[model samples]
Target: MHLLHDRGRPLPAPVPVPRDAAGARRLAAVYAPPPDRVHVRAMMNTTVDGAVSGADGISGSLRNPDDSFAFGVLRALADVILVGARTVREEDYRRPQGRADLLEPSRRPGGGPRPALAILTRTGLLPRTIEPDWPTYLLVPRASREAVVAAGIVPADQVLAADAPADAVARLAEMGHRAIQAEGGPGALGQLVAAGVVDELCFSLTHRTVGGSSSRVLDGPAHEQDWHLASLIVGERATLTRYTRA
Candidate 1:
């Protein structure tokens, strides 16, 4: 991994990223949220031609080592991981942390709780990948909470009532979260984009292109918004770009 540009200025040369702990800390600083307020960061991976996944219809097929590095760093900096239920099903999201050993040291003081995973769903139906041991939070409507829990699927304590993506974000913020990471399956990304609460987009592009039937990064009603490039880094296997809402 190497940083090519920052704050709209091109660096004279690329800086090689080391495979040590120092490198992880440096990368974490770049993705860290602004301190005084709640921030929503949307992270996504796409092919050069704008497909979010490969022929098999999962984003995993599009991931490479360099891309995974950036993704892990972003996850490490977040207070919560937000995604739609469909994304959980498709991605087989099983754990709160990935590559924990490669993350920056002392990210949380004295072995703090792992970043919470929040899934946005109307039906409250979860994939089997979500285990009983792994704590989870579900954002759904208030009226359905009782039945959803009565099904013995998830605990009542784990469910948070949210009618929409914006509401889910607000609830998360109220829970003292200042950094929210939105990892999407297109529909969820679109909802957050439409909600107008996204502060930064950590969009990544792999070196290869997948001309499959995969959808673009955002999927929903057409809407337009302006953004300014904040940082651009070119890695050995992917190009990572961060855009701030204008």
Candidate 2:
């Protein structure tokens, strides 16, 4: 990875990213959350033409090496990973493994709890193969919690019913989760944005263009908001950009 632009200003030259433990610590520092309050940042990928997925209906085909590295870094920095039910089913979501190793010891004091996986669902439907041992939470509406419990999709203890996205975020914050990273499926991203809860967005723009009717990084009603470019790193295969809410 190399720095291409910072705050919309072009860099005179690209800086090569180190590939070692020190490098990981440096990259993690770039995205570290503030100590005061919870911050919700979303990580997403899209083709040059704005399509988030390929014809096969999955975003994995659009990912490159740089994107993968950035994704891992984001996960390592987060206290919890948030995703939608649709993404869980389509992506064949599995419990994240060995993520603790990715975290720098200083970032997590005395080997803190590993990042947990939190799924947003209105219907409470999840794949049967979801690991029982994984630390998971289902954020749903209060009205749906009983139905979800009756359906037995997940244990009652793991289910968290919130009135809306803002409420869910607040609840997570109250539980000491200050670094929340939402790996979204469009609808969920849209909801988070609508709730005015997103503080930053890390988008990996693939070099190729996939012109199709696939969903964009955000779906649903139009939301007009301003964000300032924080940094833009150009990789051999793609460009990773970070935008902070302005």
Candidate 3:
């Protein structure tokens, strides 16, 4: 990754990252969260023109190797992944597995497990194609718990009821998940931003521009927040930027 802008420290010069153990550790350090307490960061990919998806209505078309590498590193460092129900369905979300080499060493000595999945859904609706073995927390409205359970989307033990976005995030922090990352579906991200719970945003900007009616990275009612550029890493086909909430 090329160092374009960095306010923290002088980063190493850009180099082609090999798909190996050492490369994974190096990438994780590029955006590692502070270990003191829970930090909520949003990770999203967008085109140069600010479209979140292409004509196919999916964000995969805009991805490149560097972005995929960064994605895995972020997931490996996170304690739990927060996502919206729509993103889970559209992205075919499943239990993260087979990356023990990347995720295991990041865990605390007695930590419960490596990165659990927590989905936010007000209607308690989930995709039918979700894997049964993939454990997840269905954060639903307190009143909708019964309806969600009846839908058989997930096991009863994994259901978590919350009144608002802040509540769910707070609960996760209480459960010792301090390094949190939200892989969003815009609406959920907007809620977190509106609630003033987001601490940072990691955006991968692809070089291509797909002009259409596709949503921006964060979508919701008009709510403005200030962010400061923390770092910018230029990749071969995309640029990875980290913005901390001001």
Candidate 4:
């Protein structure tokens, strides 16, 4: 089934042009994807100096109002949002309010066909604090079935028996989710990339120097496949680079 929203008007003018490397990065973030297509974007915000966060020496926390708006637009455009348990636990994730806050209202009528939330975990470690009624799923390894059942995460037929991330995507597809976005914790992204399932990547580069040799975009050794640059958006404090699997 088709998963993208229909557009009747011409696409909005692109977000602004960047004056420097940093600004270019921001512009890249906003214009990275075409308005059409059942695409999946991976979002990450880094420091001007290339850090994901400053807390505990991590550098991902470089947020500006413009960047937030751009992200809001991206989320509004998505059909499903998937993240790792570690991302939610460390990132203070709130249940999506609805599509109105995003870019599409009809899609979010009663608060959404709000992108269904999917959490990746092998042992059912997803927190119990999340709303039970929320359209959420905890994808666990088959060996963890009993543990997940015990934890009360409904063991839906969409279980990914293998721990491979690509298999998980296939299972989600079989269950009828055609388009999927992955919000990652590196390891998960690596597995997805290794499995060869990622369609597009939206990388946000912050303008501040967060000097740390810690983690990076893709966790493991680089894959041999080529990824083409699809688009670019530059924000005031961050640059977003879009890449699609070639």
State each model's CA lDDT, in order: 0.79, 0.79, 0.79, 0.59
Q: What would the TM-scores of all predictions be?
A: 0.92, 0.91, 0.90, 0.75
Which stretches in model 1 have alpha-carbon errors above 4 Å?
A: 98-112
Off by over 4 Å in 2: 5-13, 97-100, 104-111
Per-residue CA lDDT of model 1 for 1-246, tens digit only, reads 888777767879986665456776777766667766788999999988999988888899999987888888777777778998998988898675744763445353212356778888888788877875665778889888777777666677778888877788888877766778899979989988988989898888999877857898999768899998888888878999999999
Stretch of 10 with least lDDT, candidate 1? 103-112
Candidate 4: misplaced stretches above 4 Å? 1-39, 56-60, 97-112, 154-162
TM-score of 2: 0.91
lDDT value, residue 1 of candidate 2:
77
Mind giving the per-residue lDDT tens digits that candidate 3 earns over 1-246? 655556655556645445567767766666778877778999999988999888889887888987887787778778788999898878878875424677665542215456778899888777876665655788888999888888877788677788898888977776678877898888888888888999999998988888879998888767888999898877778888899988
Steric clashes per prediction: 0, 0, 0, 27
- Candidate 2 has its poorest 10 consecutive residues by lDDT at 103-112
Reference-based lDDT, residue 179, model 4: 54
State which candidate has the highest TM-score: 1
Q: What does the lDDT come to for candidate 1? A: 0.79
Against the true structure, whose lDDT is highest? Answer: 1
The window of 10 residues in a row where model 3 has the poorest summed lDDT is 104-113
RMSD of candidate 2 to true structure, Å: 2.3
